[model samples]
Target: MFSGLSAFPLTPMNESGIDEAAFVRLIERLADASVDSIGALGSTGSYAYLSRAERARVVKLAVEHAGNVPVIAGIGALRTSDVQALSDDAQKAGASAVLLAPMSYQQLSADEVFGLYETVTRSLSVPLCVYDNPGTTHFEFSSELYGRIAQLPNVRSIKIPGVPANPAAAKAHIESLRALIPSHVTLGVSGDASAAMGLNSGCEAWYSVIGGLFPKTALAITRAAQAGDMKAATRLSERLQPLWALFDQHGGSLRVVAAAAELQGVVEHPCLPLPLKALDGTGRQQLAVLLDELELA
Candidate 1:
């Protein structure tokens, strides 16, 4: 399993469709930065908006451009069979791992959740990363649910979100889970603002959104912390304060990446599907400030 800051880049899109050249350029640029791994077609990558064919194309591009770095394919789907099929495609595309988020739908029993992972894992040749982003799912994994998942054979890691406000509580939850689960089941963290929280809490790894635009900054934070230099990590993360705020102010990571991808000229138009607003004029201004501060331009 890979560790450190893993970035999820937004897919480049325009009026016609995905911009192949621009997408390649973005990946090449990211590879120059210190990313431990790259995750594609994730929430930050706007995976839900793309068609099945488009998703495969995006995953293929990411894996090819990633070089020696590990690739985590986000194969989240609405149906169990669809998810399993996507997982199979990821393995075929050379992804080292795949992320599975339980999609929103009717109330799910524990058996269904188990079956979802079972079906997807049984169909795949590679490890399956269990993604639990409750904000979108409208359902959180209880410690009991995670305990059940923790025992599964093909399960690789659990991508968990930070607890509200209290780092101690978050640490306690993760520690409790880790003690119950085997050491092979890694605990991956989301939300870069809480990254320090995750690291301090003994999280082995993290998945990043800001890394899509500022990979160096994300890597710096993770590296500095891993080296036990808290001060350097704090200052480096503080420099990325604007991007974090942009993620929150814009409703989520998808909007933040879409907006930044446009400002950086990495993608043409940077338009998103319905329900997610592309960068408005003011959002564009915020993006410019974000890039200018990072010296990305």
Candidate 2:
């Protein structure tokens, strides 16, 4: 069903390239924490920057070391053939499922978007998670499109980003998505800041960045929300607000989390791709204080 707390671990790197040793250590930590699943090659993993072979290697590493946790590999690309080939490779590497976003250099039409999934679905035996990340993909899915894609064969889940931070609006949006999609298709939310509210709104899963670094804490909140303890969930969510504010101010979690992971000694270096900078000294100082205050450090 792909429900519960799915951690999106950072792809650690050293001077030569991907730090295989660090990658193994991080995955082992998540497994030790009992995260529901592991998502390798996700946005946090910088799937786009790596070569095809590098991505394949990352998936192989994830499937091997993630310790019985289902690995969801990202197979998104600008072209259909590349996506299909990656999906095939992820399946060969023993990934439980592949995540896809309709990323394009030129804008894609609705039919094009539908065709992309249809093509990939036809080539895969495993299920797919439709990644509706408009912020990065530059392609948005309408409610009708959600219904249409939910009908596609082997489309098991929808990973929607930026579910409103407000609990009321988040609930309404979740309800609308529930009404629009088939019951078989589970709804997963991805924004770390809004995740608690989104889960409270009845999302089946949380594809989380923070969970990668602190799965124990992430699981605590998810378990509380799942157990119908709103008070506990809200309190936990409030604890994360400081970090969430940094994410908001910086425009995303990738850089902020990269810094936090390094500061907490989870990763050796931030090692973000060009043009994307990690938090400065001041930002790290602030993050350190927040992590300590929230007991995340």
User: Which structure among the candidates has the greatest TM-score?
Assistant: 2
Q: Candidate 2 residues 1-297, lDDT tens each?
A: 379998998887644678888788889888888888898888888887877888899999998998878899999999999998899889999999999989899999999999999888987889899988887788989988989888999999999886886788989999998999999999998888777887889998999998888889899988998998877987897878888899988878888888888878777765666666678778888987888788872
Which has the greatest lDDT?
Answer: 2
Candidate 1, 25-143: lDDT as tens digits: 77776777758888887787778778888888888998899887788999987898788778878888888989988885797777788778777776667877788888787667877
Where does the lowest 10-residue lDDT sum fall in candidate 1?
Answer: 162-171
Clashing pairs in 2: none
Give stretches of model 1 more than 4 Å off: none
